[model samples]
Target: MTQLKQIKLIAFDLDGTLVDSAPDLALAINAMLVDLGRSEFSEQTIRHWVGNGAEVLIKRALSGTSVIAEDLDEALYLKAKPLFNRHYSERLCVASKLYQGVGESLAALAELNIPMAIVTNKPGLFTQPLLEQLNLARYFDVVLSGDSLARKKPDPLPLQHLVEHYQLNIDQLLMVGDSKNDIQAAKAAGCASLGLTYGYNYGEDIALSGPEFVADSLETLVELMNGSVTA
Candidate 1:
């Protein structure tokens, strides 16, 4: 557990960590593909293409494989981006849902009076909508989308922004997410990270990223954080 006694603030990643957003994302991806006169892949296939923001998600969908095509047409990509956005906005909460125990877990954390925020690479437009749709918006004090800052995850700017916003040392913040981007950002920001096993991690295990703790569910996380020293 590495004895995470110094954690003062917790920053969560939106897409994978809290919500299983792949089904709706796949619908949006397939809609974009159909617009471009291409065949669509299954939700499972599209699930692996997530983790990065919508731009890369569209790029991977256009490539039709895990490895994004090197020859994707720039103009065509420009067309696909807006198409995906429109389609995603329409079905923002259609098949998307909060992962099990998210609400109760967040409430548990709140009971501890721990400050929390959301730091995600999902775009600003889609991020808040999804949270409000799932009723998860009330739990966070700060929400930073990909476009909210100069840079997003894997760059540490989002986490760094949180560290600055709360007036805490970076080490006192703990990041919780399912992707390497989250862990990488936390490591770069000199904070602790808790990796979840259930979210999209590009078909690889989140534990491979070497977070301070790897959990299969958020229920345990409440226990993990509740038992840790806050003072």
Candidate 2:
């Protein structure tokens, strides 16, 4: 793994990396499904469907396991979108929480005078409120939600934009996340990546995705940052 001294800017993927939001997301998704007279998916199912953003998650929920978005009926998506948004708005963070060591890690990073940003595929509507309620809003220099850009993670648009915003070289950036989208986005943006083993990865191992490092808790990252030479 690269030393933390090389990381001038650290970008985090929201849902599974910094926080565990699956429970809340599942509640809203199920509420929408029930409103549509469809069977509700389990929380485990919803967790697997997340990371691609709300639209894709809803589409996957409507289509079931491993189904492509094209398989989802457009009419159902159009109907479910509003319902899901409304439900999620109400349930945001009711059951969600920062993962172990998230607060401490964020504090440690802030103490290091490092600039950090959140690059999440979650819609801005839910993202802002969740961050605010969880008291995580102050930790980030910027927050780029899925709706903030025409494209999100796995596309590199957000990371590229952050590089421009910070006026930093891509080599000086690190992406910390829970899924392959984060790694793919980091690679495409020419940045290093760290993956979390405990976060959702479509039920697969994050290591298989080839991130520079993998750990189960943010405390490990804090340790790295503390041990690394100052940037």
lDDT, residue 117, candidate 2:
96
lDDT of 2 by residue, 74-104 (tens): 9989999999999999999898999989998
Displacement of residue 48 (Cα, Å) in model 1 is 0.4
- Rate residue 42 of model 2 by lDDT: 84
Residue 90 CA displacement from its true place in model 2, Å: 0.5
Across 1-231, the per-residue lDDT of candidate 1 in tens digits comes to: 434667889999988899999999999899888888999899999999998898888988888887889998988889898999999999899999889999889999999889999998899999998999899898899999989998889999999888888999998999999999999999998888899998889988898998988888887778777665322
Tell me how many residue pairs clash in candidate 2: 0
Against the unseen true structure, what C-alpha lDDT does each candidate score? 0.89, 0.89
Candidates' TM-scores?
Answer: 0.96, 0.95
